[model samples]
Target: MPVASLNDIKAKVGADLGASPWIEVTQAHIDTFADVTGDRQFIHVDPDMAKQTPFGGTIAHGFLTLSLLSQMGAGVMMVPDTTKMVVNYGFDRVRFIAPVRSGKRVRGHFTLAAFEEKRPGQWQALHNVTVEIEGEDKPALTADWIGLIYV
Candidate 1:
């Protein structure tokens, strides 16, 4: 995580934080997510059947890609050292704009959208997050994510 002071965080509002390292979305990962979420959609798990679809082959679940933001954002955006805890408040909006086929690489690009002290020692932040599929013009997804930091 990018450790910073409260004031430092405030200073970075509306700034582009950075991009996370690329992460491969393999078929194994997709299958495991399907098992855990019980979303056994043919497009996500049935490789042979999925080949007939326009996606050509199995594609990762949209939620699976959305869930990756946490892992992708851990170091890309962060709270100050004084913060006792942090929480994923939720997202204002989320759009799955493109498909991420199995075996593809993706990364997250983040921008600090909003930051305010809701109350003393409690801060709320909004992040504009985009998941880019490697070598693809269109991003896999975009979200207005929110986080709460406790100091």
Candidate 2:
């Protein structure tokens, strides 16, 4: 975990938070995400059916890849010692730029885009997050993700 104070974060608002370790996007992972989200699209759940599609095989759900940000962010950042709680504020924008085919590896790279104090001991942060597919030129997705840190 990378620890930084409110002043430190504000000072480096546009700094790279760094990338997370690569993780495989398996068919099972996609299937479970689909089950949980009730988003059983053939391209995500049925390999045989998806093989005939443009992707040529099953791919991960965009939201599934996006959801990994929480886990990935953990590897890239730590809650500041002064903060007692943190919560997802919401996303300002999100775009799925590429498909993450099942069994492919993916990782997240983040930049701190914005930081502001909403009130005493409460701060708002926006991060520019990109999910990269291994060996691919284009990223799988990009988002302006926001979080609320309470101190």
Candidate 3:
């Protein structure tokens, strides 16, 4: 992660923050997510059943991919040097464009879309995020993620 002054961080608006390291989406990951979320959908937890589907095999849940943004963003985000805390303000929009098959790798590409001071010691940042699946022509997901930072 890059550490910069608030002004310097804000200066990154419209800049590409770069891509995060690739993370493999294994069947175990899918199963754990399914168990935790109680979303026992056959396509996510049952490989044999999923094999007959269009995806060919079990696929990671869309929310599983979306939830990865936290781990992914930690690798590429810019943080203010004086920041005291940060909070997820939620996404403005999210679209799951392609299925992420189990055992495939995915990474995040982030761009600082907007940054501004919302209060004397608080700021809001909007990041345009694309989660790309390795070797795939289309990205797995895209979202506009918001964060609130306090310094």
Among residues 3 or more apart in sequence or in different chains, the pairs in candidate 2 whose N, CA or C atoms overlap within 3 Å are: none
Q: Which pairs of residues have clashing backbones in candidate 3?
A: none
User: Which sequence of candidate numbers ranks them by lDDT, best first?
Assistant: 1, 3, 2
- Tell me which of candidates 2 and 3 scores higher on TM-score: 3
Off by over 4 Å in 1: none
Error of 2 at 89 (Å): 0.9
Locate the minimum summed-lDDT window of 10 residues in model 3.
1-10
TM of each candidate vs. truth: 0.98, 0.95, 0.98
Q: Quote the positional error of residue 136 for candidate 3 in Å.
A: 0.2
Off by over 4 Å in 2: none
Q: For residues 112-134, could you state the per-residue lDDT of candidate 2 as single tens digits?
A: 88888899888888899999999
Model 2: lDDT equals 0.89
lDDT of 1 at 144: 99
Model 3: per-residue Cα lDDT at residue 133 = 99
